[model samples]
Target: MPHIFTNRLGGVSSGAYESMNLGVNRGDDPACVRENYRRLAALLGMERGRFALASQKHTDIILRADFRHAKNDVFDPADFVADGLVTRERGLALVVFAADCVPVLLDGGEAVAAVHAGWRGTALGIAAKALRELGCAPGSVRAYIGPSIGACCFETGPEVPRAMLGLMGAEAEPFIVRSGEKYRVDLKGLNRRQLELAGVPAGSIEVSPDCTFCLHDKYWSHRYAGDARGSQCGAIVML
Candidate 1:
């Protein structure tokens, strides 16, 4: 996968979404976001006009975006209400943004996809939808699980684990740990399991070692930063 998983280290945003805030609809200065996107495009060796993005809704809805949507002047929420995007068009970059959610990238056989899988989307099988949209057999797809809230700091009530257990069963059990009345959830690990269950090979999955919640300075952690946070992004290219 020709992908770039970026932290909030390099950009020109200020205040809350400081430096590399990739979110355009988050009330930040559009010029700043544009500059950040420009920097990102330069790093990826792609034209900023070719970098397509979606307004991730934490749903299983998968949409295909190209340079057209990438250059749309409007930032309406409906313009890109997709959790996952798949494309076979080379030079068009697919981007997925997240603060605490898992940003998954999968590419194989001239097709690639970027997915935003929060807990709700995970329960709803967004990753599986991405695989299907990419038009690749699950076994042939290589997945990259990007930085997200990790087990180290993802303390949640039993309801979280219950939803996961109900959605994934014992296959996801090992990633959930019991801690008194709370559960320490390994969302990335469980999402990897979700990919596996969807037929993606376990050996083909690569996970980022950094955890958003634990590495808050390096990432934007909604759980740790509340409403005032930036975003990290997962960008993939199809070759």
Candidate 2:
């Protein structure tokens, strides 16, 4: 499995999307977004047309992708709306975009998956669902939880914690802490726990310590830059 979590560096987009902006519908120049994909394809030794991007909408939907889903350019409209993509086809790269949301990559030996886990998606158990979609023994799967908003900066009202608690019960308590009038939720930790609970070994899951909101200069952060920001992606291909 070949995988990468892109950052805000190394592209041609300018202004708020300066440099590597992989998101196509984020108000970024379409030409610049295409060039960013080109650069990424070159770096990964993959064909630009072999990439299958998820039309993420913070849902738990997972799609099994193949060459038919590949797009020749970033401007092409996605045929499906899913927050996660799983594929056993070699050379058909699966990609999921994220700013302050968690991007998870799974390598299940014969298959691979790319998942975008926003708070809503996490509550819907998108990570575990993606793992189940892999159709492999969980212990045999290796996962990477990419950079997102950390607990230190993810201040939210009661709704977020309530949603997590309803899904994870007592298991979600440790990751959600009181923050004066609000709460700080650890989305990465929750996603990791979901993977582990689904049978993936804790040691097999590598969690990135980088917080998108904290390292906004290196990665895109929706909370930090709002709607004007670009999005990075987590891409995987079984080759």
Candidate 3:
């Protein structure tokens, strides 16, 4: 299986969506976005039709995908509104899009999942949900937390940290840093903790050091670029 977290390089989109913008609704031309997807599909050595996408509303919904859900178009409405997708079916690639939010990839050898974990999704424990849907023990899953808005740049109000506390109690404390009246939430660490709590071995997870907000040149950041940004997608295919 091949898995990759895309950046903002390559492709035909121009202006705010300078190049390689995979998002279909961020004001980028639909033709360009489709072309970008074709490029990504080419790199994966699969046709665009093999990709199964998540609708991504920041919910914990994990859809089980197969050939029926596969689409060649990224702009088409998904059959389900989900933040995570899992499958044991080979030849179907799972993809989820994000700008500043975290993209987590999970592989259990026999199955694979792709998740979109923003603060809301994280609070909802989307990571664990994906693992559970794979029908695999957490300890056997290998997780990779992709580039996202790091805690250093994710300043938030009480609601974000409070949601985490409500879900994880004191276990979420270390990942939430308070400075003045605001909080800095570490989305990556919070997701990792949720995976660990679900029984995933700490050593089985890998976290990317790249921060989307800090490295806006290489990645798109909704926090840094607002709604006029392209999206980065994390995709995984079962071999």
Candidate 4:
């Protein structure tokens, strides 16, 4: 399995998008976004037409994809909406886009998955769902949690912490920090905990040290750049 977590680098988009904007609907020029996809696929040594692009919606839905879902055009409408995509097909890439949201890659030998986890998707356990659907046992799977808004930059009202606590209970305490009237939740830690709860080995999960918000220049951060930002994508292919 070969996987990549991209940042905002190496492409033709301009302005707030700058370069390397992989997202199709973030107001970047359609042709530029399409070219960016081609460039990405070329770097991965695969045809851009063979990639299965995820239509994310902050849901736990993990769709199983193969050549049946492949398309050359990244801007084309998707037949399905899912936050995660799993596949066993070799040379077929699965991609999920994100700005500040988490991008996770799971390698389970026969199958691999690309997951986008915003707070809602994380709470819904999209990572665990991908593993379960791929028939991958937790211990056998290796996970890479990509850059996103870290706890230090993720300040929210009580509702966000309450939701996290609802899913993780007291186990979510350390990741949730009380900062005056707001709470800063470590989404990466919480997502890892959820994966562990679903049986993924804690030792097998690797969390990115970079935070999108903290390193806003290196990566795109929705919190830092709202709707005017471009998005980075996490992609995986079974070789």
| Clashes per candidate, residues 3 or more apart or on different chains | 0, 0, 0, 0
Off by over 4 Å in 2: 47-49
lDDT of each: 0.84, 0.93, 0.90, 0.87
Model 3 root mean square deviation, Cα atoms: 1.3
Model 4, 160-221: lDDT tens digits are 88887887789889899999999998999988888888788889899998999989999999
lDDT, model 1, position 27: 80
Tens-place lDDT digits, model 1, residues 1-239: 46899999989999998989988777888888888888887878765436678677778888876666665532434555788888888888888999999999998776898999988888787888888888878889899999999999989888888888888788778988999988898889888888888898889999998989888999999999988877779998754
- Weakest 10 consecutive residues, lDDT, candidate 4? 41-50
Error in Å for residue 128 of model 3: 0.6
**TM-score-best of 1 and 3:** 3
Mark the 10 consecutive residues where model 3 has the least summed lDDT. Answer: 41-50
Candidate 3: residue pairs that collide: none
Number of the top TM-score candidate: 2
User: What are the RMSDs of all candidates, in order?
Assistant: 1.8, 1.0, 1.3, 1.3
Q: Give the distance in Å from residue 151's predicted Cα in candidate 3 to where it truly belongs.
A: 0.6
**How do the residues 110-199 of candidate 3 rate in per-residue lDDT, one tens digit apiece?**
999999999999999989889889888788889999999999999999999999999999999999999899999999999999999999
Weakest 10 consecutive residues of candidate 2 by summed lDDT: 41-50
The TM-score values for the models, in the order shown, are 0.93, 0.97, 0.96, 0.96
**Superior candidate under lDDT, 1 versus 3:** 3
